[model samples]
Target: MRILIVSWEYPPVVVGGLGRHVHHLATELAAQGHDIVMLTRRPTGTDAVSHPTTDTRVDGVRIIATAEDPPEFEFGRDMMAWTLAMGHSFVRTGLRVLAGERNTPEQQPWVPDVVHAHDWLVAHPAIALAEFFDVPLVSTIHATEAGRHSGWVSGPTNRQVHSVEWWLATESDSLITCSASMRDEVTRLFGPDLPDVSVIHNGIDIRTWPFAPRPVRSGPPELLFAGRLEYEKGVQDLLAALPRIRRTHPGTTLTVAGTGTQQEWLVEQTRRHRVTKAVRFLGAVDHQGLVGLMHRCAAIVLPSRYEPFGIVALEAAATGAPLVVSTAGGLGEAVTDTTTGLTFDPGDVAGIATAVRAALGDSAAAATRAARARDRLTEEFSWSEVAERTAGVYLAAKRRVRHPVGRPSIPERPLPERDPGQSD
Candidate 1:
């Protein structure tokens, strides 16, 4: 199958989980014998005069970066301008590929069997290309603007992005969400006219992450939080719980890894709570540094008020790290409370404190749970399985497009069994 993926971010230009998701999915699909071409924004420092659009390959997948430099202006206006520029570039690239001008005599024209778009940022281009080629369009809604702002569209920017999200959900032949919670949210926002939605969980390559044997800690217990330092992320709530956490587990320290708009406010909260000395804010750490921190920390906490799918939780679990996650959105679906990891209600300071103390105090039990969580990663959330499920979605979309009437529903694929002796 020939597949074309349109996303706003890719390798070396990622802002969050979406970039990594696309990268791994595309590469895995290509490895499975599919022709994959990824279209994403061009990173900084690329010579536009020499290469207006750059084409590169990684692990058998082709990546094309065509977006122009972003404008320096207001946030909302800049986003609108960037979307238009990206759409224009997609059109140019789509035309060239459809024309078969870039193909050799023996090779066929680079026409895609399916066009998949990630999030609303690339919705315009995805829709346009799908319409032009008369092919099936599949969209993956990683998260929603409405959900991010707690069902409130505060301003023009919020309202505009929400509108785009609705458009993309309604227009796509098939919609894919990272979690069942996200699928429900999409349906609630878009009404009954929305297409068939599929839930495909985000996955990680566990073997790539370095996991050293966690040594028994004799000093103050270290708790790690890694994600965007924002209000919705519930980092402030974690700060609120620190006082109580310290009361039970004296001298406990918190290390936050990641940067966002709420960094300054989080710093202030620490001072207000008088736990300033106990908190260490490490702005942002690379993958290697994060893995190192994960292996060292007593437990990893994800106190998100709204998480579409907790990919970070998967990363933590893969490292055999004890977890304390909030029962918000898809997080509850990801971590099985008590069995794999413990759960707390979002923004519940008492609950966060209790869970953290439990994880820190019970070394034997925590290690057992962490090992189970790692086993779950291999059993259910491997990239190879996710890519295969995604391919099923594409096939279902194509079938639906070809035969509108009496189209059968795509059944959920069962989880594949993992060999006990196999690694990753």
Candidate 2:
């Protein structure tokens, strides 16, 4: 199958889970003999003059960086303006490719068997391209702004995100979401007949992140949190729970590993709660640093209020770090109580404190459970397996587009068993 993947972010440049998801999915598809082409905005330092004003191949997959003439780098301005301008350029250039305006004998236009768009950020380009090319488009809704803010906030950026999401979901041949909760949200917002939506849970690279023997903490029992320090992530809730946690587990300490809008607020909470000494805020640790932390930590907590699919939980599970997740949104789907990890109700300070203490005290039992979780992750949610499942979705979209009616009745294959921690 020839697949053209449209996304706003890619590796060597990380915005969020969307970029990382696209990168891994594309690579896995290409490895499985699918002809893959990725379309994204040109990254920083892309030589407009030297860089092909056209298609280029990276790691056996064609990559089309948008806009032949990119804007000159300007320092000390509103970054959002620059991002919007670049996004526009990317969409315009992608539209041209889909329209077959820049075709060549050596590199023909992207006549994909499937047009797959990752998220709302690239929906404009994906929708335009699908229309121009007259191909079946499969869109993945990684997150919904409405779901993120729970309709409480509707500012300009939030509104725009929701608008694009609506357009993309309405236009797609088949829509894909990471969790069932997300599917419910989409149906509630868009009504039925919006699109033929499917749930394809996000997966991790199990081989690369095999379960290692976790290191025993010599000094303090380190409880690790690795994500954006925002309200949705429940960082504030974690911070608030720390005061009660330290009252019992004095040797317990927290090592935060990401930064976001709520950094200052989190710091304030730490100080006000007088648990600053127990918390070490290591802002934005890189991939290797995170893996190291996972191996060393006594427990890995993902207290998200609205996680579409907890990819981070899978990553930590793959490393044999017993999980502690909140019972909210997709997080409930990502942890099995006392099996893979334990769960606590969101904002239940006593429950969270109790869970943390329990996890810290029984290092040996947690290690045993972590090993089982790792085995489950590798068997059930490997990237290669998810890629094959996703390919089936692409084929389904193509078949529907090619023949709307009178097609031979085909029985749907029974989907793989929904792991207790999975979101189908």
Task: Indicate which candidate wins on lDDT.
Answer: 1
Which digits, one per residue and each the tens of the lDDT, describe model 1 over residues 273-339?
9999999999989988999999999999999988999899999988878989999988999899999
What C-alpha lDDT does candidate 2 achieve relative to the native structure? 0.76
Colliding residue pairs in candidate 2? none
Q: Give the per-residue Cα lDDT of candidate 2 at 47.
A: 51
Q: Model 2: how far is 156 from its true place, Å?
A: 2.9
Q: With candidate 1 superimposed using the best TM-score fit, by how many Å does residue 47's alpha carbon deviate from the native?
A: 6.8
Q: lDDT score, residue 304, model 1?
A: 96
Tell me the deviation in Å of residue 72 in model 2.
Answer: 9.0
* Per-candidate alpha-carbon RMSD to the true structure: 8.5, 8.0
Which parts of model 1 are misplaced by more than 4 Å? Answer: 44-47, 67-77, 97-100, 103-108, 399-424
The superposed Cα distance between candidate 2 and the true structure at residue 263, in angstroms, equals 0.6
Model 2, position 275: C-alpha lDDT score: 83
The CA lDDT of each predicted structure is 0.83, 0.76
Candidate 2: Cα lDDT at 292: 89
TM-score of each: 0.91, 0.86
In angstroms, how far off is 132's CA in candidate 2? Answer: 0.7
